[model samples]
Target: MSINWDDLKVALAIVRHGTLSAAARALGTTQPTVSRRLDALERSLQAKLFDREAGGLRPTALVLALVGGLEQMDAGAFSIQRQVAARDTGLSGEILVTSLDWLGDDVIAPMLARFGAAHPGVQIELINGTRVFNLARGEADLAFRFGSFEQENLIERRVGEVAYALYASTEYLQQHGTPDVGDGFEGHRLVYLDRAAGEVPHEAWLPALARHARIVLRSNGLRAHMAAVRDGVAMAVLPCLLADREPRLRRVALPHPAPVRWVRVGFHSDMRDTPRIRALVDHVVGEFELLGACLNPKQ
Candidate 1:
């Protein structure tokens, strides 16, 4: 039986996610499309690939057996594709950089703007979210994230350190007395980072310090947290690089050292020699250098 690779891919996505809606998100397609492709895939193989249940879709034994081979094929295809593209020495091409939403706003976006202005021929796209890009599989041309990259065949570069501290607007401090770490921030209004923001290393630190403070609001975006603080609603842990320069924001005194996270930028080594990759890395690093110690505030 001849199996179309595209249809097999859809089936594999369904297997991975266990639901047509989830598979659609993974494949960047519609739910109907995922259902249709799954149907076509199963029809071509002449077997029941999945059993739909109340919980989700469960792959049949036959389809389960094909899962491993399908993943290998997917990886091999992307590897070959990027390897071939790596041969291009041209400076003018498209590049995708992935970063966390706040980091993108504070640093990555500005760096991209500088790089794009300098190299007008290069097209750039920045995806900001909590999801880390898989560089080896051509998921992103470059990735800026917190911590080190353990992925093989990748070169990691230190971007900068992100220092976070409690901040509140002058108006907020006027309305509600300044919180004291000695009091464990009791009676303070806190704007918390949303739980869905995902694995933040410094996340626990804030609540640890504000053990008694009431959470007035929760936001997934750091920008929203900063805005709320600026509006005199509540205080929140914000990046020093962003909040420090704002005249309206005041850094709250804390007995404990602020949370600091190191940001790293990396790309697949296969694109090491690619002109665009080299240029981008150099441009971003250089731009970050201008920020200097502001990125890493005092303890």
Candidate 2:
């Protein structure tokens, strides 16, 4: 009577998500694979776990009876995995890291290149997105985010402060004219970041900065926001380090400087002393000298 931990994970994922397709997504497998695995698990246990319903997969009495134990097992497995990872002294093995697209591409990517040169044996998997990965669940080994981490159980450290300012294309400024600060860009157009990109300190600042400006466009990404500004359609509050590099756009002068946001690196509390994670964290913190110039633009 052998049962695979992976099949149990599939069952738990199905129980959590309530659908084969959704569970497959969480498990990073196909829907058919989830169905097959569920069938096999049922055969092994000689009990049906879920019922097919129009709404979704409904757990049967057998699954309901064992679900709690299954969850405990899952947590225990993750705990053991974290414990083993924490004890690793070698700098080898893959570390999964996540961050926003622009930050990962512009700021961290270059730093990673240098790190790669020094530690050729260390493999890095960097994911760029606005979605927050659960470090406590080991979804990502590390994360770089604009605001403090949501989970208090994780370890967080300040990496750098990012400066932002109003920016407009030379052509847009020529056509619409430069915005007067206090006026809230009343007559001008604004391009805003979509709320879907995750809540951050700077998200609120954009609206306050252009209180009277009409948001003509809303983008979920900096790449699109910067493109809209460069296209001369609308101006936006963009990071100085990034916006300043664009030849097509110029920073809008104002009475008070724009808002600033802090970048924080976070990892699971269990990984605090892990050699690889520590090495990476230390390397990133040490780059503050270089990050300062890249994060905060010169006034």
Best by lDDT: 1
The total of clashing pairs for model 2 equals 0
Show the lowest summed lDDT stretch of 10 residues, model 1.
197-206
On residues 83-122, what C-alpha lDDT tens digit does candidate 2 reach at each position? 8878876887778989888988887877776776789888
Residue-level lDDT for 69 in candidate 1 = 97
| Pairs that clash in candidate 2 | none
Predictions in order: lDDT: 0.85, 0.83
Q: What lDDT score is found at residue 145 in candidate 1?
A: 87
Give candidate 1 misplaced runs (Cα > 4 Å).
Answer: 52-56, 150-154, 175-188, 194-215, 253-256
All candidates: TM-score: 0.83, 0.89
Which one is best on TM-score?
Answer: 2
**Stretches > 4 Å off in candidate 2:** 195-200, 206-212, 294-299
Displacement of residue 179 (Cα, Å) in model 2 is 1.7
Note each model's CA RMSD in angstroms. 3.1, 2.4
